[model samples]
Target: MADATTIVPLNPDEEKFLRALGTVMALLPRVVDADMLEELPISSTEYTVLVHLSEVPHHQMRMSELANVCGLSLSGMTRVVNRLESQSLVTRQKCPEDGRAWLALLTNPGWKMLEQAWPTNLASVRRHIFSRLEGCDVAAAAEVLQRIAAP
Candidate 1:
């Protein structure tokens, strides 16, 4: 292993790429969240939770697992689920397989909410992300991102 105090300088291109990546990481979520809030009843994070639940079998997932997938702390996920539950969009139940754990279940109302919000989410994504990539190879970009994000 290299010495902890050793310094390796970044090339100009590498430095530029890192700067742009940091800015995008900071900006993208705020922009998307703003768009979602402007046109829909839900924020982007809430919409994400709904989308994940909708895609899963039985429209249910463990609360901890949901937190992981959503990139939220367990408490944060609980709070989001609480808001959804209050709106009658989702429900929390004891995990059948693990009594100590909780599960998040999408409700019929949640499906309706997702269906209603789909267009706005799609438009927001296209407008804020894909449109900016006009002539870029989107597939390659996605593959690179997936690799970067892999555990």
Candidate 2:
């Protein structure tokens, strides 16, 4: 392996790609959150949490696992869940199998909220992302993005 002190420079195209990726990483969430907040009662992060919970069995997931999937810290996830809980959209219960852990469970209201928000979310995504990719090979781009996102 090269020494840690060694300097490596990106080519112009690589530099441009990295800059664009960084911008998107910073901007996409804010744009989507704005759209979601305008037309729905929940922010993008909360919607994302609900979406993940809805996909799992019993509409529940361990709190830590939920945090991981949501890309939030445990404390951040707790705050978000607390908000959802306050709205009657989700509930938290101590894990039966692991007493020290907790689980976030989606409520009936949460499902309804997701259902109500789907169309707005779809329109936002299509307008902000798909609409701009008219001539691009989307599947190939998705594969590249997936590879980059892989752990």
Candidate 3:
């Protein structure tokens, strides 16, 4: 690791921006989690997994792929998938082409759950995020944030 003494502190504008970004990063999840817990049966993480699976061709994806898409560790994804499987929201099956790999497939109930949750999720996003910004603000923020978040 580099020596702490060599590091330069952020300038005031950079500090302000980072603080605001950190606040939003922390608070936005809580806001979304509260809405989800109140209006739906799933948490935000589960919703993310489901949404990604829903976007795929067959409502199914490899466990590792799902983990990557959801930004979860392999073990973390396994735990989440186990919970979802217990709830009958998803099913885990051995991959046909690869005997050692597993696939997570969304169930009918999962689809229904997602459908029911969509309106609540959308409203919460609007209430917490989009409502606070104008169109141009949203576009600019999206561009900037995406750039910052990109690998």
> Backbone clashes in each candidate structure, one number apiece?
0, 0, 0
Each model's lDDT: 0.94, 0.94, 0.91
Per-residue error for 34 in candidate 1, Å, reads: 1.1
**lDDT (10s digit) by residue, model 2, range 58-150:** 999999999999999999999999999999999999999999999999999999999998888888888888999999999999999999989
State the lDDT of candidate 3 residue by residue for 11-127, as single tens digits. Answer: 999999999999998999899989999977788889888899899999999999999989889999999999889889999999999999999999999999889888888899999
lDDT of 3: 0.91
Candidate 1 lDDT, tens digit per residue, 8-68?
Answer: 8899999999999999999988998998889877888999999999999999999999999
TM-score of 2: 0.94
Better of 2 and 3 by TM-score: 2
Indicate the residue-level lDDT of 119 in model 1: 92
Off by over 4 Å in 3: 1-7
Off by over 4 Å in 2: 1-6
